[model samples]
Target: MSEQALTLKQSGVRWLWVAIVIFFADIGIKLWVMDSMGYGWANRIEVLPFFNLLYVHNYGAAFSFLSDQAGWQRWLFTGIAFGVTALLIYWMSRLPAKEKWNNIAYAMIIGGAVGNVFDRVVHGFVVDYLDFFWGSYHWPAFNLADSAICIGAIMIILDGFRSKKLRTSN
Candidate 1:
């Protein structure tokens, strides 16, 4: 009814759109990759010295951690994902108007988490395709959702450090 109320509603809508876009796009790509490549089909094509499109499936979290667990991890991760998504939505909804970057970071994390969570819920595993390697060392394989989460984390960290630096310098 009031101007301030209208503004708040619009801002909330915008953030909802952001979350939906990221979540849907991540899920769509992952589904396409799964269907086109099939599970465990590594269509390796070296994009650079360090990057490769190496397909893989992960039944657990980062670095295939917990992938070999005996039981119950699938449901555990699904529950965790749902909890994180709910928390992110609540946090993003409360973000001030000036905190657009923080909202964006949260959206990324929420969407990415949901994308992988969907896979875990439906298939009991997350599909990973992107691989990075250098000489004898290799990074963990990941997919679009993982990439989104990584970028979101970096943005949040940068925001925190930047604000801290500015406060100290002033």
Candidate 2:
């Protein structure tokens, strides 16, 4: 980052505090779950008819993709996270200070990425909870970091479509 980029006051980088907050919140929740809860479906705490708090570890990507494979996915996902973080930071540094939505979205992704990456490096897998289910089917267990990333990704996609609409109408 150049001097101009380093001066966060004038760029979307100012929104990094959002990322920091998300990171800590994700980590904190994972810690609480780890300390207070037991692992697996048998130990799950039913919070609602459709939801549960279950402890599990994801050694792979979203929806536990490739989880059954060998251990190499850990390094692959970790590398991808680092690359994405760097790119988002660079993009944020270039954005004007007035751009809040995209900055926030990028920051959120950064936070979630960092949080999961921290888990991967420290625990050799990501800690997961927050199970939503209906009848015999249950969604893959995930944590706060995954939620942030999904929301942020959705926001970015929505913004892209919205920007296109605005530009065409102008």
lDDT of each: 0.78, 0.93
For this target, which candidate reaches the highest lDDT against the unseen true structure? 2
Candidate 1 steric clashes: 0
- Model 1, residue 113: distance off in Å is 0.3
Candidate 1 minimal-lDDT segment of 10 residues: 10-19
Stretch of 10 with least lDDT, candidate 2: 1-10
Candidate 1: tens digits of C-alpha lDDT, residues 1-170: 99867766755325656667877887787777767764443466678998877557798897888999974788888888789878877776566656788788888887788888888888778888887888968788888788888888899899999999999999
Model 2 superposed RMSD (Cα): 1.9
Tens-digit per-residue lDDT, 111-159, candidate 2: 9999999998999899999999899898999999999999999999999
lDDT, model 1, position 111: 77
RMSD of each: 2.5, 1.9
TM-score for each of the candidates: 0.85, 0.95
